[model samples]
Target: MTRLISALLLFALACASAAVARPNILIIVADDLGWADVGYHGSTIATPNIDRLCREGVELNRHYVSPVCTPTRIGLLTGRYWSRFGNTGPNNERCLPWETETLATALRSRGYDTCITGKWHLGSLPEWGPRQFGFTHSHGSLAGGVNPLNHFYKHGKYMKTWHRNDRLIEEEGHATDLIAREAIRYIRMERDGPFFVYVPFTAVHTPFLEEKRYLEAVKHIPDDRRFFAACLVHLDEKIGEIIKAVDDSGQRDNTLILFFSDNGGQNPSSDDSRRYPDTKPTSKFKGMNTPLRGWKVQTYEGGMRVPAFVNWPGTLKPGRSDALLSVTDWMPTLCALTGFKPTANLKWDGRNIWPMIRDPSKANRDRTLYCKGPGGRTRMVINDGWKLIEIKNGERFELYHLDDDPNEERDLFHSEPDEVDKMKRILARERKADDDARPDPKRKNPSPV
Candidate 1:
C-alpha cells in the first residue's frame, strides 16, 4: 500500500509539473491602426474579437509607439529605443539592424517555437529576414508594407508571396486573410508546446485594397469611409479566426494574446492637395485621431499613441490600465512573463509592464517617453504630465501639460519655464545614456532630424 501511494503521488506531481509549464504567446500587431479604431476604444468599427480581448483582459489606455512603423517595430522587438541602434532613420530598411537581439531570439532560447507571419518591415536584406533573426518559421513581406493585389515589394516591385518556413508560395486571398489563415494553422500545429506566434498584419496600412465581400458589406457607410471601416472589420474577423483556432486547439487557458497597433494611421489628403494645392479633394484618406493633434509622421500624441491589450484566459483578470506603457516595454515584459532572464549586459530603456498586467493599480511607470519623427527631424518627450516637443531647426519649444491639455493645443513653454527646464534636463540625461552605449560613433546622432 505504501508503494501504491508513492506511484500515485509521482503521477500527481508529473501532472502538476506539466500544468506549470510556460504558456504560449500570441502577439497580434495591426499596422497603422488608430487609438480609437478598435470597438473598445469608441470606434464604430466592428472589432468584436479585439473588443472581446480587451473586455476579458487588460486594455492599456496610455500605450505609445514611434511616430512610424519601422522604429516602433525595432523598439518592440529589442526592448530598447531604436535611436540607441541608429535605427531612427526615415527608411524602413534602416530601422531593424542586423546584429540586434529580437524577442524571437530570446524566446527561442527558452525552448519556445518562434514563428512570424505578415509584415516584416525591418529589413529586406536576405541575411536580416525573420528566419535569420531567430524566428524558426517566417512567412510574409520583407518590406515595410505591400500591395495586396499585385503582391509587390517596396517601390512597387513584385515579389513572390511567401509561405510556411520562408517557402515561396502563391496566395489567392487578401494579404490580411492569408496572414490569418497561416496563424491559425500554426496554432493548431504547435498546440502541444509553448509557442510564440507574432502575427503583424499589414492591414489598414497603405495601398488600400479591400476585399469585395467586405466592401459590399459596408456599402451603406458611404464610399469615403466605407473601405476603411471594411478593412478594419476584415482585420477584426481575422483576429476572431485566430482566437477560435487557439480555443479549438484546447490551449485557450494556457495562451497569452496581445493586440496592439504599430503606429498611427496615414492621412492622405484629397487630390493630394496638401502636396499640390491646385488639385481637388479626390480621396479623403485620414486616420481617426479625433481629439489628439496631428496624425502619422508627426511628433504629436495622435501619431505615437496606440491601443494595446493583453489577454491570458486564466492568468490576467479583465480590466483597463491607464499605466503609461510603450512598445519598448514588450520585450522585457514578455521575458518576465515567460521566466526568461534578459542578458545582463543588455541595457534597456523600457521597464517590464508585467506588474501592470497582473495588477493595474499597483503599476508605477512614470518615466519619460521619447519619440523621434521621420528622418529624426522632430523629437518629443513625455515626462509626468508635460510633453516637450522640439521640431527640427525650429527656434521655439512647444510644451503641453497633458493632464490639462491632452490635445496639445496650449503651448506652455514660456508659462511653465521651470517644468520645461526640468524635463529638458531629464531628456538630456536619457539621450546621453543612449549615446554612451553605442558601439559606433557615426551611428549616434543627438539631433535626429
Candidate 2:
C-alpha cells in the first residue's frame, strides 16, 4: 500500500514537471505586411498594439520567409522549405500529403489542443482543410486572400472558402473581426494543458476594403494608403484582443506569442486591376517597403525579410537579434523550447534557433539558406555573409556580400566570380534534394509545377 502511494506521488510530480515545461504557443502571421509597416519601425501607420509587442518582445531582425503566402505557410507548418514539394505558388489545392506531421500535429501528439484562426491557404477545398492537418478547430478562409466582408475567393467554385472546421458557413462579421472573435473565444475557454493557436491574418492583403470605422479613423492618411493603414490598424487591434484574452486566461507568463509578416507587401504593378478589384486608388498602391529593395515575389531583402518579434514576458528576455533565421527554424526551435519531440518522419531543413534567440549577438554563421520564388523566377542561396540571387532561373544573376550591403543594391558578380560559383553550386545541390523529395511534376495536374 505504501509502495502504491509513493508511485502515485511520483507520477503526479512527473506530470507537474511536464506541465511546467510546456508553454502555450501563439503564432500570429500577418499577410503582405512590409518592413516599415509598424509603429516601432517608424512607419506612418498606427500600430500601437503590434508596436507594443515589438517593444516588449525580442525582435527577429533578420527573419526570412518565402516571398509569398502559401509557400511560407508550408515552411512554417512543416519546418521544411516549401520548394521541397516542387511548388512555390499559392497552394490552391491540398498542399500537404496525408499522414504528414505538421507543427500542429507534432504539438498535438505532445498533448496540445491545437487551433487555427484565419487564413489557411495551404489547401483551398474543404476536403483538405486544417482539420486534416491536425488543427482540432479551424475558422477562416481556406483561400489565399478573400474579400474582407464578402469572404469569397475569386468568383469560382472555390469562391466560398470561408469555413468553420470542414463545413462552409456564412458569418456576419468582417473577416478580421470574425477571426479575432474566434481566437478570443478559443483562448477564453478553460483548458488543463498547453494550447497551440496559429492566427494567420489575411489583413492588409487584398482588395483593400476597410471597415467603416477603421477607414474613418485613418482618414488623415492619403489616397490608397488610407485603406492599407486602416487594415493594419484593425489587424493590430485584433492582435491586442487576442493578447488580452491570453492575459485574462492567466496564461500570459507561460504563453509565447510570435508575430511576423508572411512576406513583404505588394508593390504597384500593371496587373493590379486583375489582382485586387476593390483597391480604390490602384495607381500607386505600393506598400511601405522603404529602405529594402524590391517587393513581393522577388528574392530581394524586401520580399523575404520581414518585421518579426516573439514575446514571452518573463520567460524570454526582450531584445533584438540579427541572427540569420527562417520560418523553417520555428518548428525545431518551438519543439526544443517546449519539450516536444516530433514523430520521426521526413528530415527537416531547419535547425533549432533557441541558442541564437537566447544570445542576441550569436549567429548561425555557417548556415546556408535557400529560396525559390515564382514571381521573379527568383532563386537564392546564402552562406555566411555571401548571397547569390539568380533571377529568371539564372537568365540574370547578382552576387552580394549581404553582411555589408544588406540591400542587394550593389551587384558584385563580376568582382567575385569564385563566390558566385560557390553559391550557385550550393543552390544546385539543395534544389536537387528538394526536387527529389517532391512528387514528379508530370504526375500532378491541378497546380502545375
Candidate 3:
C-alpha cells in the first residue's frame, strides 16, 4: 500500500511538471488595426494597454500578414499561405478541407483547451465554423465584422452570424466588450490543462458605432478618425481586461500572450452603412498606416506588415525585433513553443520563429516571404530584402530593395532586371500551388487539396 501511494504521488508530480512545461497561449488579434494605431507606434489614439504590452513584450516591428482579413486568419490558423487554399480575399465559403490540421487542432491534440472568441471569417456559416476547424469552443461572428448592436454580418443569409459554439445566438453588449468578456471568462475558468484562447476583436473594423463614453474619450481627434479612435480606445481597455484576467488567475507568467492586427488599417472610404441595420454613418471611414507605403488590401509594407508583439512574463524578454516575419509563423512557432511535434507533414509554409523570440540576435537569417492578394491579380515576394510586387500578375512589376528603401518609393525593376527575374520565378513557383481549394459553383463545398 505504501508503494502504491508513492507511485500515485510520483504520477501527480509528473502531471504537474508537464502542465508547467505547456504554457497557456493567448493570441489577441485586432481587426483592421493600423501599424500607427497603437500608442507604442506613436499614434495619437490612446492604447495604454496595447502600449504596455508592446513595451513589456518583444515588439515585432516587421511582422507581416495577408492584405485582407480572411487570408490573414487562414495563414494564422493553418500556418500556410491563404493562396494555397485559393483564398486571396475575404471569403464566406468554407476555405479549409475537412481534415486540415490547424493550430487549434495541434494544440488540442497536446491536451490544450482551445477556444476562439471573436471573428472566424474562414467560413461564414455555422456548418463551416471554427469548431469544424478544431476549436473546442467558439463565440462571436462566424463571418466578418457584424453590426455592433444587432450582431448581424451583412444584409444576407449569413447576416445573423453571431453564435456560441457554432450555434447562432443573440446577445446585447458591444462586440469588443463581449469578446473580451468571453476571453477573460475562458482565461479564469478552471480547466485541467493549458488553454489556448484566441480573442480576435472586431473592433475598429467598420460601421464604427462606439458607445458615447468611448466616443467622448477620443473626442479630440478629427471627425474622420474620431469614431475609429473611440473604437480603438474601447478595444485597448478590453485587451487590458483580458490580460488582467490572466494575471488575476495567477497564469500571467505561465501564459504566452501574442497581440497583432489582422491587416493594416485602410485609408478613408465611403462608409457602406447601408449593409448593416440602423447604422447612421454616411461619412468616409479613416485609418492610418503612417510612414508605410500602402493601406489594407495592397502588397505594400503598410498593408501586410502590421504591429505585433509576444508577451510572456519571465519567459520572453522585453525588446523590439525587426526580423522579417509573417502571421503564418504563429502556428509553427506556438506549436514548437508548446512542445508539439507533428506526426506527419502538415504542409506548413511557416518556420518556427521561437528561437528568434528567445534570442533576437539569432533572428537575422535569409528567408523568403510570399503574399497574394484578391482575384489573383496582385502578388508579392520578399527574398533577401528584395521586395517585388507584381501588379496584374506581371503587366507591371515594382521592385524595391526594402533594406535600402523600406517605403517603396523607388522602382528598381528596370535597373535590377535580374532581381526582378529571380523574384518572378519565386512568384511563379509559389503561385503553382494556389487555387487548390477554390469554391466550385456547382458544388456546395470545394474539395480540399
Q: lDDT by residue for model 1 over 195-230, one digit each (tens)? A: 999999988775566768887876766577776778
Q: TM-score of predicted model 1? A: 0.87
The TM-score values for the models, in the order shown, are 0.87, 0.91, 0.93
- Score residue 292 of candidate 2 by CA lDDT: 88
Query: What value does the lDDT take at residue 371 in candidate 1?
Result: 71
- Candidate 2's displacement at residue 88, Å, is 0.6
Ranking by TM-score: 3, 2, 1
* Candidate 2 lowest-lDDT run of ten: 440-449
Q: Which stretch of 10 consecutive residues in model 1 shows the poorest summed lDDT?
A: 270-279
Cα lDDT tens digits, model 3, 355-402, are: 889776665548889988878778999988899999985789999999
Q: Which candidate, 1 or 3, has the higher TM-score?
A: 3
Question: Model 3: which ten-residue window has the lowest total lDDT?
Answer: 440-449
